[model samples]
Target: MSKEYLDGIIRRSLEIRNKYHELERLHHGSEWTVEEDALAYLTDAGLVGRNIMSQQQRWPKAGSQTELEHKLGENIWWLIVLAKRSGIDIKDAVNNFLTETEAILK
Candidate 1:
């Protein structure tokens, strides 16, 4: 897919996840907790980590590209949800840590 199309999907995903967070805040679900959303995010994180290692041929496990891509996409979607929940811009948060690392290590 083209970068433009990908950006549209990213923005759309964020919009949907943000709405989910709002619903969560209102306790719209039967349960009073947003544990489901949190779980989905964590699961995606683990899968994506595995996918990265697999891509690098360091996983020492079995998996196909199609599955890996899905995991990676899911991970990205969840990361955006996490950022939204924390009131953080994903790009800004990464840049801040990268910028501070030099001083911290020096």
Candidate 2:
């Protein structure tokens, strides 16, 4: 992806994270720790996986496709959130991963 696209994603993720933190503060009175955020990311990922499985099996309920798409977006948002919380630049990490994997394949 282009730098602009990646930067846009990062900027949007920060906005979402701020909004989510505010919501959490209203309900829970505090921001979550890095570990808690990581757990939330994993939970969302698992829900996405389950939804994918349901779709593949043709056993999806009403609006399952929409729910799947929503969850996929949530999963990506949480990934960026977790990366930020852990002080990692997700774009750089992804680029490094691609480079390493390509080198291994070569």
| Local accuracy of candidate 1 as per-residue lDDT tens digits, 38-78 | 78878877877887787789887676467789887777787
| Tens digits of per-residue lDDT for model 2, 2-104 | 8999899999989989998899899999988888888888898888888888888756566667889999989888888888888899888888999999999
The total number of steric clashes, by the backbone 3 Å criterion, in model 2 comes to 0
lDDT of 2: 0.87
Between which residue pairs do clashes occur in model 2? none
Clashes of each: 0, 0
In terms of TM-score, how similar is model 1 to the real structure? Answer: 0.57
Runs in model 1 deviating more than 4 A are 1-10, 18-35, 50-63, 102-106
Candidate 1 weakest ten by summed lDDT: 28-37
Question: What is the Cα-based lDDT of residue 34 in candidate 1?
Answer: 45
> CA shift at 15, candidate 1, in angstroms?
2.5
**TM of each candidate vs. truth:** 0.57, 0.90
Among these predictions, the greatest lDDT belongs to 2
